[model samples]
Target chain A: MLGLAAVPLIADVIDEPFYTVMFSRMLILSIGAISLNLILGFGGMVSFGHAVYMGIGSYVVGIGTFHAIEDGISWMGNGLIHLTIAVVFSALTALFIGSISLRTRGVYFIMITLAFAQMFYFIAVGNDNYGGDDGLSLYTRSKFYNILDLSNDNSLYYLNFTLLIVFLYFSHRLINSRFGILIRGAKSNEKRMENIGFPVYRYRLVAFVIAGVICGIAGVLSANQTDFVSPAVMHWTRSGDLIIMVVLGGMGTLFGPVIGAVAFLFLEEFLSGITEFWQIIFGPMLVLIAIFGNGGIDGILVRLDKWWQIKK
Target chain B: MNWILLLEQIMNGLQLGVLLFLLAAGLTLIFGIMDLINLAHGSLYMLGAYLAATFTNWTESFFVGLLLTLPACMVLGMLLEIIAIRNIYTRSHLDQVLATFGLILFFNEFVRLLWGPIGLDIQLPEILNGSVELIFGIRYPAFRLAIIAAGIIVAILLYLLVSHTKLGMLIRAGASNRQMISALGVNINLLYTIVFGLGAALAGLAGLMAAPIMTVEIGMGEEILILTLVVIVIGGVGSIRGAFLAALLVGFIDTVGRSFLPDILGFFVTNDVADTAAPAISSMLTYVLMALILAIRPQGLFPPKGV
Candidate 1:
C-alpha cells in the first residue's frame, strides 16, 4: 500500500504521465474484476453480462454530462449524482436480469446473462441523443470543485486507488461475514443450502446486485478516466474480458482480480504494440491458457507461499 | 403497408428462417451427438461465405463456388476440431466457451488478413440475378426464393438422414447414450469429427447462400451466431425438429418485427424515436421471447429424450 502510494511521485520524477494513467485504468478495472469475483468466484454464478453494469455506469455519467452541457441541467454536473443514480439503476437492472436468469442453471444462466447484455448493447446503440454507436465524449471530467479536482491526473489516480482499497477492504469483510459465507455455501452445493432452509435465490440475487453496483462504480471512474462512453462497453466481448481477468487472477480470491487486471491489461498493451492484429496471437494464447493455465497467477503465488512456509 | 410489400416481407422472413435453419441444424446436431458447445460454428459460416465469394470469382460460376465451399468448409471444421475443439470435450463449459471465443477472434483476424478488412460482394448467377413474378404483377428476387427452396430441401434431406440412415441411427444413439455407442465399438471420435464437419458444411451452405444478399465481411458470423444460439435454445438444445421450427419462428418474429415495429411504435411515440428504437427493440424481441419461454419452460420447447 505504501509503495503504491508513491507510484505517482516516482512516475512524476521519471516524467512518465503514462504510468499514472495506465495504473489508474488498471485500478478501475480491478474494482470491476473484484466485484465480478464477488458473485462469479464465490457464488459460482458465471455472469457473462457483468460489463453491462459498467456500461450503464458510464452511460449514466456520460449522458448526465451531455444533458448537463446541452440542456443546461446544472445539477447533473456533480459526480455524486452520477454515482447515486448509476448505483441505483444498475442495482435494479441487475435485480431484473438476475431474477429471470437465475431461474435457469449452468449453461442457461450464462446464455441469459449474455442475452441481457446484448439486449442492452443494442439499446445503447439505438439511443442517438447520447452518441449511440459512436459513443459519447465529455469535454470535462466529473466535477467536485470544492472537495476534489478530477482534472488533476494525480488526484484522479489517487482517488481511483483509494476507492480500489476501500472496495477491496469492504469485499474482504463481506466475504468473511455470515451472508457471504451463505453465498459461498450455495455455490458449493445449492441443494445442501436449500435443504438447510436458506433462501438461496434471494441470497444470490443480493450478491448479484452488489457486484453490479460495484462494477457500476468502476464504470463511473472509467468514463471519467477516458472521458468517453460508448455502446461498445456493453458488448459481450467486454464481459468476456472481465471473465478472463477473473479466471486469470484466480477465482474466489480478493487480490486475484487486481492481479488479473494488471496482467491482462499489460499483456494487451504489449501484444497490441507488437501488431494491430494482436488478436490473432491473443486468440490462440487464450485457447492455450484455457487448456493449460490451471491455477492463475494468484493461485500460483498462494501455492508458493504454502510451499515456502512448509520449507520453513 | 401494401399487401404486396407485406407478402414480400413475409417471404423475406421465410428466407431468413430457412437460412437460420441451415446454421441451427448443424449447431444442434453437433450438440446432440457430440455434446459440444462450439462457438466457432459461426466461423465456419464466415469461411463458407469467403470461400464462396473467392471460388465463384475464380470459376466464374456461383453454383460451382458454392459446391467447392461445402467441402472446403467441412475440411476446415474437421481440422479445427482435431486441433482445438477435441481437447476441450471433457473440459468445463467455461473452458469450451473461452477457447471457442479465442477461435472466433483468431478466425476473424485470419479472415481479415486473408481477405482484407473490406467486405466482398458475390455476384449472382444470370438465372438468379433478376426478379421473378410470383403472382399477378407482383415479383420477388429469384435468389431469395432459391434460398428458401434450398433450405426446405436440406431440411427434408436432414430428416431422412437422421430418421432412416444407419449413420443417423448411430447419431441418435450417441445423443442418447455415448457410453452405449462406444461400448458397441462405434468410433465415437470419428463420429464426433463427422458430425462437426457436417455441421460446418451446413453453416457454410447458409453463408454462401447469404453472400449475394449481404456483404461477406469480417466478424459477420458473430452477428448471426447469437441468433443461432437463440434458435437452438428456444428449440431445445438437441432437437433438430425443434431447431427448424424455432428458427422459422424466430425468423418471422425478428424480420417482421423490425419491419412493422416502428410503424406500431409511431402510433405511440414520435416518428424519430420510433425509427431510432425500432432496430434495437426488434432484434431484442427474439431474446425477449427466449427469456419468456425459459421462464415458462426452463428446459426449452422440445428437449430431446434421454441424457
Candidate 2:
C-alpha cells in the first residue's frame, strides 16, 4: 500500500512517465484480480472465463465511440454512459451465465464458463464493424462532464489509484459483513450450508454478479489506458492470468490481488523485455508455485510477521 | 443446394467428428480413471504433431513417421504423468487446472522455440493424396477415408481392450470405484500411467492425421481442445461411447452450420443482415447445442454407469 502511494513521487524523481503508466495498468488489473478473488478465493467458484467481462466492458467503450464517430452523436461516446452500460451489461450477462453455470459443480462449471467465454470470443471476432480480429482503436480518451481531463496522464493515473483504494475498502467491508460469511461458508461446504436453511445458490449468484460488475469497471478503465479494445483482451489466457494473480498474491486476502497484479505485470514487462518467449520461464515458475507454494506471497508474509513477533 | 455438395459437407463433418473423437477419447478416459482435468492434454497433441513433422522430414515416409510418433508421445505422456501430474491427482481440480495450465504455457513456448513460429506442412503420400471417385460421380479424398477407417479401428480396439482384456476390466473397475479396485490389490498407479499413455497416443494419432490437412503451428492444440471439451461434455464425461457420439454430433452441427447458416438466414432476413449475423450465429451453434443438452441433462447424453 505504501509502495502504491509513493509511485507518483518516484516517477517524478526518475523523470519517467513509464512508472505512472505501468502502475496505472497494475491498478486496473488489480481491480480485476480483486473481483475474481471475491468469488474464486472466497466462494470457491473457479471461473475459467472471468476475463470475458473485461472484454465486454472494453468493447462497450470501443463500440460506443465507434458509433459516436460514425453517426456523429457526441452523447453516445460519453465516458459515464459507457461505464454505466458496461456495468449493467456485464452484470446482466453474469447473472445469466452464473445462474446456469452455478447449477453444475467442479469441472462441469469450469468447462461451461469456458464455453461461454469462447462463444463471446468468436462473436467478438465476427464483428467486422469493431475491426473483427484486429480490434478497434480509440481516437480520443473518454470525456467526462469537464470535471477531469482523462487525456492528462497524471489525472488518469490518480483516478485509477483512487478507485483501486476505494474498491479495496469496498471488498474489505463486503467480506466482513454477514453476506460474505455465508458465501465463504458455502464455499467450504455447500451441503452443510444448504442444510442450515441458507439459500446457497442466490448468494453465489449475487457474488458472481458483483465480481463481474467490478471486473467490468476495470475493463472500462483498461480500454481508456490502452486507447484500444481488442478481442485479445478477453482471450482465455487473460482469465488464466487473473487466476494466477489471485493465487500468487494469496487467496482470500484483501491486498493479495494488488500485490499479485504488481508482481505479475512487472515480471511480464521485465521478462518480455529480455526475450520473446518469456512464458518458458514463467510457466515452470507457475507450476512450481502450484506444487509448493500453497499459501503464496501472503502466506510467506504472514510467516515473516510471526517470526518478527517471536524475535521481539 | 446440389446433392453432391450436401454429401461432401456431410462427409467433411464425419471426418471432423472422427478426428474429434480421437482427441476426446484420451481426455474422457483420463477424466474418468484419474478424475484429473489435464488442460495440457492438448499440449500432448501439439507435441505429437511437431514430432511427426520432424520425423517425417527425417524418414521421408509419412507412415513410418506416424508409427514413430505413437511410442514417443506415449512415453512423453507417461513421463509427464509421473513427473508432474501424479502429484496433483490427490489435489483439487483447481490445482490440477493451474498446474496443467502452466504446462500448456511451457509446451507452447517450448514448441515455438524449437519450430521458430513457422507452420510446417505435411505432404500426403501419393496414394492418399488423390480423391477417390464414389458412386454417382462424387469424389472424396482418400486420406480422409483412411482417417475415418483408422479412427473406427482404434475405437473398436479400445472397446475390445476395455471389455475383453483384464487391463480393460481393471480400467472400468477403477473408473467405477477407485478405492474398491485398489483394495482388491490392483496396482492403480500403473493402471493410471497406462491410461494416461494410451490417451496421449490417441491424441497424437489425431494430431498426426490432422497435420496434412490443418496447419501445424503453435497453439493448435488449444483451438481443438475446447471443441473436444464441448464434445465430452455433451457426450458425458468418462464414457467412450458418449465421446464418440457427441463428437460426431458436434462436428456435424459445426460444419453444417458454418456452411448453411447464411443461406438459412438469408431466407428470412435481408442479405446484408444475414451476412453480418450469420458468421456470429454459425460459430455459436455448437455452444448453443451444448448448452441446450446440458440444461436438459446435466450429466451429459450418456453418463457412465454408476458415475
Candidate 3:
C-alpha cells in the first residue's frame, strides 16, 4: 500500500509523467485480478467469462454518456450514478449467470462461462447504436461533484490508486472473514463441506457476484482511463488474461494479483517494444511458469523470505 | 419462407456441424482418455490450415497438400505432448488451462510471423469448384457436399475403429480406466502419444477442409474452438457418437438460427427490433440449448457408459 502511495512521487522525482498513466492502468487491472482471485483462488470457481463484468462496467459508462449526449441529458455527469449502475447491472448479471453455471463442475463450468461471455460479446458487437464493433468514445471524462476532476491525469491516477487500496483492504478483510473461510474450505473439498451442512452453492454464488461487482468497479476505472468502450473488452481472451493474472500473482494470496498485474503488463509492454511477435516469447514463458513456477511470484517471494530468515 | 433457401441453410448448418464434429471428436477423445483440456488443440488446427495452404501453393494439388499436412500435424502433436503436455496431465485443471492458453498465444504469434498478418484464401480444386443441384431448385457447392460426405465417412470409420479394432479397445479401456489398462502391461505412454496424434490429425483435417470456404488466418482455430467445446459438452465428453450428434444439432441450430431468426422474430416484434436483435439471439441460441440440456441432464445427452 505504501509502495503504491509513493509511485507518483517516485515518478515525479524520476521525471516520467507516463509512469502515472501506466501505473494507473496497472492498478485498474489489479483491482479486477483481485476480484477474480476471490472466486478462482479462494472459491474454486474458474470463471472463464469474468471479463464480461469489466465490459459491462465500461459499456455502462460509454453507453450512458452516449445516450446522455444524444438526448442532451446532463444527469450522467455524476460518477456515483455510473458506479452504481455498473455495479448493480454487473451484480445482477453475475447472479443470473452464476446460478445457472454453478450447477456443473470442472471443464463444463469453464466452457459454459466462456460461452456466455461470447454471447454477451456478440450482443455488444451487434449494438450498432452504441458503436457496435467499432466501440464508443467519450466526449469528456466522467465528472465528479466538485470534488475531483477525472480529466486530470494525476487526479485519475490518485483516484485509481485510492480505490485499489480501499478494495485491497476490503479483500484482505473479506478473505480472512468467516465467509472467506467457508469459500476457501469449499474450494478444498465441496462435498465434505456440504456434508458438514454448509450451503456451498449459496456461498459460491455470493462470492461470484462479489467478484463480478468488484471487477465491475475496475471496469469503470478503465473506461475513465481510456475514455472508450468496446466489445473487445469482453472477449474470451480478456477473461483468459484475467485468469493468467490471478495464477501468475499467486492464487488465494492477497496482494499477489497486484504484483501479477504489474509484472504481466510491464513484461507485455517491454516485450512488445522489442518485437512485433512478442507473444511468441510470452506464450512459451507462460508454459514455463505453469510447469516450473511453483505457486507464482508470491510463492517465490515466500520461499525467498524463508531463505532469508534461515540465513539470518 | 422459401423452401430452397431453408434447404440451403440446413445444408450450411450440416457443413458447419460436420466440421465441428472433426474438431470435437479429437477433443472429446483426448478429454475422455487423458482428462487433459488442450486449448492448443485449436492451435494445431490453425497450423494444419496454414501448412495445407502453403503446401497446396507449392504442390499444385489440394489432395497432396492435405495428405502431406495430416502426418506432419500428427507428428507435431505427439512432439508437443512429449515435450510440454506430459508434465501437466497430473496437475490441476487451472494449470492445464493456463499452459495451453500460453500455447495458443505462441502458435497464433508463430503463424503470424510466418504468414504475416493478412489472411490466406485457399483456392478450390477444379473438380469441386462449382455448385451442384441437390434438390428442387436448390444448388449447393460441390466442395461442401464433399465435406459432408468425407465427414460422414470419417465418422463411420472412426466408429468402426473404436468399436471393432484392437487400438480402439485400448482407447476405450483407457477412457474408462487408465490404471487397469497400464497395469495389464499395455504401453500407456505410447497409447497416449498415438491418441494425441490422432486427435491432432482430426483437428488438422477440419482446418484444411475449412480453409477453402473460410479465410485461413491466425486465430481462426479459436473462433470455432468454443463452439466445438459446446458440442462435446452437450454430446457428453468421451463419446464420439455423442459428439457427432451434438455437433450436428448445434451446427444446425446456430446456422439456421442466424439465417431465419429475424424472420421469426418479425412475427412478434417491430422490423427494426427484429433486425437488431436477431443476430444476438441466434448467436445465443446454442448456449441457451446447452444450458437447458445441462439443466435436465448434467452429464449431457450421451455420457460414456462407465463414466
Instruction: Give the top-scoring candidate (lDDT).
Output: 3
Report per-candidate DockQ: 0.72, 0.78, 0.83
C-alpha lDDT of residue A172 in model 1: 98
Off by over 4 Å in 2: none
lDDT tens digits by residue: candidate 2, B145-191: 89888988988899999899999999999999999999999999999
Winner by DockQ? 3
Off by over 4 Å in 3: A12-15
Q: Give per-residue CA lDDT, model 3, range A1-312, as digits (tens).
A: 778777878888899978888999999999999999999988889999999999999998897777677787778756889999999999999998899899999988998899889888988988888898999998766778789999888899999998998899999999999999999999999999999999999999999999999999899889999999999999999999999999999998998899899999999999999999999999999999889887799999999999999999
Kindly report which residue pairs in candidate 3 clash with one another: none
Tens digit per residue, CA lDDT, model 1, B70-137: 99999988998889888888777777777888899999999999889999989888999889999988
Candidate structures ordered by DockQ, highest first? 3, 2, 1
Positional deviation of B180 in candidate 1, in angstroms?
A: 2.2
lDDT of 1 by residue, A230-293 (tens): 9998888899899889888988998899999999999989999999898899999889877887
**Candidate 2 chain A, run of 10 with poorest lDDT:** A1-10
RMSD to the hidden true structure, all candidates: 1.6, 1.3, 1.1
